[model samples]
Target: MNRDRSLRYRLAGIEIFAILLALLFLAPFYFVLVNSLKTLGEILVDAASLPEAYKFTNYSRVWDMIRFPTALRNSIVITAISVAGIVTISSMTAYRLVRRPTRFNNLLFLAFISSMIIPFQSVMLQLVRVTSILELRGDLLGIVVCYLGFGLALSVFLFHGFIKGVPLEIEEAAVMDGCSPYGVFWRIVFPLLKPIAVTVVILNTLWIWNDYLLPVLIIGSNKDLTTIPLAVTRFFGQYTKQWDLALAGLAMSVTPIVVLFLLLQKHIVEGIASGSVKG
Candidate 1:
């Protein structure tokens, strides 16, 4: 009876601790939402306090200034194209490596995996130079290709582990039925990879969409190609900042991703759990 009481007490403590942790994380978001409704003067005076008079016009003004619709369209196009390329190409490459398993293939896999550990900052200058030389600067297609190069390693790594768990008999049967190599992959292997594919798409979509640095470096000064993050940054100046407009712009930038996550959160959790188990 004493031991049972002790365990119950411990569990209660843990629950309380988790609740506090959740509140800690959520406080910033609460602040942002509440303050976004306030005027610039209120925000500057006491950001933590509730607004005396809510000025929802901030959002409307920010929408116009940031060209919010165009930014959303650009982000959607780049994210979709990049996610598609990463999943398709990485899956095929991982499938080949897992199925073949030759010494050369193993070495190449190691090389790709090794590249993931190299920080992008280390190669940023060189990457910029190379992209410029290739005339890939300031284009959505170029941004997609850039995402492909940086994102491929992790995608390949995830697909490689998952592909190993897939049964070889499926491929063998497809081949025996006179399906060519490509047909075997496209018909048999690709279908089974859906879970991991969804996982990759969600993960990469979040990263590429929210990403600021890469777009700033590559797509900066190209007004037509400005991403939401870059556009939001424009609201801040060296001498003075547009606090109200900036907050409104930030809210707009974050809303889509938050909505997307809420909708697909189940898949995201399932995918991560499955990948961890399989990998």
Candidate 2:
């Protein structure tokens, strides 16, 4: 009875700590949400205090000004295309690298893994030059292509480990039954990769969705292809700061990603855990 009580106490303590930690992390979001409903005068007066009156007009005005619908569509399209391309290409590449062992393949895998260490800022100038030479600047297709190239390394590295854990016997059995390489991969192997795929999707979605710099660089001066982060940036200029409107815009912007995380959260945790397991 005493041992059971002690264990219950420990679990309760952990639960209380976790709840406190979550609240601590959510503090900034609370500030944003509260301040978003207040006027600039109220914000300047006391940002931490609750709003005297809720002002939802900030969202409406900013939404129309920033062309929220167009920007949202662009962000969705770009993120979906980029993430799908990353998952497909990286999974296939990782599978091939696992199955076909060669000296050059080893070198290539090493190169991909090592490339992760290189900072993106160092290559930005050269990338811009290449984009200009190829006339890829301001193109949605060009931006998606850029995301594909940049996201591949880490994605392949992630899928590589998980693919190794998949059983060879099952693949061999499928091959003996007159299944082609494509059939075996698509019908057999790919389905088994769902867990890791979800992890890849979620991780890539957050990165590509939240990314501001790359879009700014690649899709410069293009209002049609504006993303959420870039759109939010417009409220802040050299001299003027639209804090009231900006906060409201930010709250609206982050809602989708936050909702997505909550929905797929279980899959995400399981996927990462499974991916980390050794073959």
* RMSD, one per candidate, in order: 2.2, 2.4
Q: What lDDT tens digits, residue by residue, belong to model 2 across residues 1-279?
A: 999999999999999999999999999999999999999999999999999987798899888877888888999999999999999999999999988878888888999989989898988889999998998889888999899999998889888888899999999999999999999998999999987888888778889999988999999689889998888787565215678888888888889888888998888777666655632
The alpha-carbon lDDT assigned to residue 279 of candidate 2 equals 23
Show model 1 residue runs off by greater than 4 Å: 1-10, 273-279
Query: For each candidate, what TM-score against the reference?
Result: 0.91, 0.90
What is the per-residue lDDT of model 1 for residues 7-42, given as tens digits with 9 covering 90 to 100? 999999999999999999999888888878888788
Off by over 4 Å in 2: 1-18, 272-279
Q: Estimate the lDDT of model 2.
A: 0.88
Q: TM-score of the candidate numbered 1? A: 0.91
User: Which predicted model would earn the best lDDT?
Assistant: 2
